[model samples]
Target: METVEFKGSHDPEKKIVVSLFWTVRKTIREEGCAPVHIKRIRTSRNVYEPEGRKLLKLSDDIMEDILRDMEMGNTVEFEMTMGTESLRVLIDDKRFSVEATRTPEIEKEIVEKLEHETSKLTPDFCQTFLPRIFPNQ
Candidate 1:
């Protein structure tokens, strides 16, 4: 699997994150992927360790809840598996990024779709990442 991280010109609001989430879901579904698992890990200031919940579906409401936790100075991470590929969204006070893995060819398609979709929605929110290095290559 190759990983792609999305960057933006500036920190995006919750709505933008929701848009990005939907874009990714649509792109992966186009490739015939099905939802496998969705997990939300929440960290709190008082808790000794973070708590995590495995959700049946990655709904819009859950995503919004994650954003709310992030706003409250809590760390929330979301991971979802579809087919053989996986998506991980990191949201915190300092950084926000979406990381996904797929075959090289599929990765290209996903990126292109994300670029086109996001451009239509807002200022090209899906930006660059580190050069992808495949071990077999």
Candidate 2:
């Protein structure tokens, strides 16, 4: 069995984390794994103060957009606004902006099996296996 992992983080103020995991299974199966499974995790935290009511509203708006986009199978694009004191997330070309006294944190994780050739499986062999598993897309 073999495995690989990747991790990265962006600014804590608008904190973002991304991770990917790959694993090998079943030595008999060529490449150990015929296909890869992917999973993602995202987290956000916001703190509110008396004067930060507006910022809280913004956070809610952004979170809503993120959830909607995920349901629609879309990616999120992030931007800065209000002199970098605020953040914006775009979904399906629509943008939502928010301000917060304390920046919110965001994290994402993905785990999947990769069809990497071991001594038993070669790149040429994967060509035949991929089509059967991923017929379309």
- In terms of lDDT, which candidate is strongest? 1
Candidate 2, residue 101: how far the Cα is off, in Å? 26
Per-model CA lDDT versus the true structure: 0.46, 0.27
Pairs of residues clashing in candidate 2: none
Q: Pick the candidate with the highest TM-score.
A: 1
lDDT of model 2 at position 13: 16
Weakest 10 consecutive residues of candidate 1 by summed lDDT: 128-137
The root-mean-square deviation over C-alpha atoms between each candidate and the true structure, in angstroms, is 10.9, 18.0
Q: Provide the lDDT at 15 for model 1.
A: 32
Candidate 1 to truth, TM: 0.43
Q: Which residue pairs overlap in candidate 1's backbone? A: none
